[model samples]
Target: MRIAAGLIAVVAVAVVSSSVPPEPRRAAAQETAVTAGATVETEPVAHSGDAADDPAIWFDPTDAARSLVIGADKKGALETYDLTGKRIQRIPDVYPNNVDVRGNVVVAADDDTDEGVLRIYLVDPTTRQLTSAATVPTRVTAHGLCLYRSPKTDKLYAFPNSVSGRVEQWELTVRGTVVTAKSVRLFTLGRAVEGCVADDASGALYIGEEKVGIWRYGAEPDAGRSRTMVDGARPEREGHLQADVEGLAIAGDRLYASSQGSSDYTVYGRMDNKYLGRFRVVNSGGVDGCQDTDGIEASSRPLGTAFPAGVFICQDGYNLRGTTVERQNFKLIPLDRVVLPIGTLPIPYP
Candidate 1:
């Protein structure tokens, strides 16, 4: 009886995952996605409009003081917070919705305004404070921000997913606090894409589309010049992961993504959109009552030698009941604490 039940469950996931349109519209005809947390309970840092939208974590075991994770509250403010869950200070004048960090620097793409710009922050992770680096002109609505290191050239990349239907990857260079951007590479998806993440170890990038589902890009310096390596990913269905999928993370070999409408998360270990499992956000004095799911990130949640690393953090979409205008807030939940895994991945993000 249990065997039949198990088969039925597998059949359900397969049907939902394989439910793409038929034809030139077929997902098998589209490029595939082979890509890519846990955290605690915290009283998220509040924003003036939406409570929490996006989060980026920078881990430095050598310098724990300098290790930090930054999140966007998406009202008119940006926030700096430590690993143990402490508030740093509110960055005044930022309209950023997504946050991604590397080393001591963090980059956020500000949406809600028409300026089309990327805001760079010079961060002192120890103090949890930041100052403006420079504002670079982004051609469209900046939605997702990530740091990528090119494997072929070993050059650093700061890629931003914008509303203009193009993903921009820029080589990064910094002298003290000033950043000089170079070798800008813009790769066009068939349409607008959001929620992008990069795996520096393998030199690959994964892009998630709001209107569509998810797509993969090889991103070699020469390859990014053209649109060839995208794989067999389907356009998102209307009621599933379709509700504003805005975050991506990798653990071992699985890629985890959040669907805002259902207030739930979906996991796919391999390149394909096979739903391994699903988990929802449970509200407590937390912000989810106001917002749906938004940004997400992952790290090793250390328990003991027996278990692999396990923490995950999620960003809230709205605040104060989603009725009044307020900022977004960050919520920390451990992966092991949230869901049971079918298999343990060798490395995060295949």
Candidate 2:
């Protein structure tokens, strides 16, 4: 239950004289994608209803226009959108908070189960449909989730909110566009963990615990033990860590995390969990954007008919609530304003 004033729609452009950071190769080892004064192009994408919850962008190296955008709804529906925010598909049978597309498929981790239950769904890019993949019979108040592929073993790992205050990993099975989740390994975080992203460059991971703080979780095979690249550092918040610790993603050299109702994006250094300034996203000027963000994704796909690269999108929950007591809307955030050379195009989603 938070409300804030809005500024009129005024586009601000900053000089990007600094050398554009290195491309997202497999060697940069950068973590969070910084959106610093990222300019916002004046274009706007339209969608139906109030868009809320998590979203993921699928990279289409072959067809950028055919690329995909998927998001979570308040009623267990995963809606698909094109780059222009056009409704392409609506995947069902999911209680998802966050979704990620890693290896040719979409994986969703949602906590709509009673008691302790973990339900993961796999979405087919070809058909724009969802299949109930795996159900781990455990109790985790899952909210924020990140999926990663082990650079060496190529095993899949999921970082979700903990029932016992630690992050766990599982062996995700992908068979002909179907992914099922199974037990692999479980690890301890400083506290209840949520946001997760892997540094493909170093085969390491960056984890964000809402209250416990930001952490760098890394590991080895048999020769020794896992280690924390960044320890004892935490992100500052105004409320409980559980206040919808929803989004987590990485780009060049930083980690980005957000919480609903807080109205600000939290930042940390990839090398260490030191608190960076928080950037607030506002929809001034009667913009039809909603702000209670729940999901976020970064991609350099392209514009026009598909999600573009370096484009940052998030979900604004609580939209259209109590409106007919029937349905709600999904909100999108374009990160071009806080960061530059990024995607300026509006999230035209359905």
Candidate 3:
């Protein structure tokens, strides 16, 4: 009685849509207060265009007002939304599948192009917008993308996952404002891999292997293939990941992965990869609950009154906020509201 898989019913690509259904839907009475209300909801995008797949939170070093939520439309664009969920800029025809931001550097997957490369962009502090900076050709068609800025070495890295199971890591070097990438490490999960995130402080890389589960690897180039499956769908295991694990996001010491099979999110300890609890976004503030979420992101940086402690963003598969019909959009949750009330986690940023 697993909950049915989410957006896979609409995704035409077999490699991406193949997923194991989650256990039956849990009752609404079990919903947690951690996801009670969203601070903002973005405008709707296409329903079945493979749009609004992933999001990356970009923090402005100089001004909190300059922060942005960068997301992949998947169809052919990289969209930048203000903290209020308004579209401020759109980079068209890039065919971005996923995006990640660190400092001024922005990395996105252009797997739809014939070249199938990873594109790098830099945020302009003056304009508070993104501009094309460079491109790194990947060995395989990129499906998932994440960026890592090593806390130890301070070197920047880009990781892109291919539908065929290849994961490539590239170290980026900048010279005279031009960014260049050199592939440093390549590995395989031997299964479809999409959602991925890297913890710079811990030097850990977490990737979602669709039907299988979430796996973690070392973030270093020399870090070998020896890995750990943080959670799985197997019944005998204590792990709670159902199937078709779609997105991975790290906030402080907690790792959040979407269990699309059950339409819920499983939370784990980022260090030990231990399952702590689970929660789902429900209808609040006149907005519908998010289901079949493909991509999710969070930042621990305080942003004024709305998100004093930080913010969390999840892709809403079926958004019916203002209109009668449904489309895809994003939901924002305050980090303080989630962690403070739960008493499960120590505030990471504070």
- Which structure among the candidates has the greatest TM-score? 3
lDDT: worst 10-residue window of model 3: 7-16
What C-alpha lDDT values do all the predictions have?
A: 0.58, 0.50, 0.75
C-alpha root-mean-square deviation, each candidate = 8.5, 10.4, 5.8
Better of 2 and 3 by lDDT: 3
lDDT of 3 at 216: 89
Q: Which stretches of candidate 3 lie over 4 Å from their true place?
A: 1-35, 46-48, 234-238, 340-350
Per residue, candidate 1 scores C-alpha lDDT tens digits across 130-242 of 88888777756677777776656766677777766677776778889788776466777757666777776565677776666656676555555433222223244533364
- lDDT score at residue 341, model 1, on the 0-100 scale: 55
Best by lDDT: 3
| Candidate order, TM-score descending | 3, 1, 2
Cα displacement (angstroms), candidate 2, residue 166, comes to: 3.3
Q: Which prediction has more favorable lDDT, 1 or 3?
A: 3
Give stretches of model 2 more than 4 Å off. Answer: 1-51, 114-123, 133-141, 177-180, 219-245, 259-262, 268-277, 284-286, 301-309, 318-336, 340-350
Cα shift from native, residue 252, model 2 (Å)? 3.9
lDDT of 2: 0.50
Please give the ranking of all candidate structures by lDDT, highest first, separated by commas: 3, 1, 2
User: What is the TM-score of each predicted model, taking all chains together?
Assistant: 0.73, 0.67, 0.87
Off by over 4 Å in 1: 1-39, 63-66, 112-115, 225-240, 270-274, 283-291, 301-308, 318-327, 338-345, 348-350
Candidate 2's TM-score reads 0.67
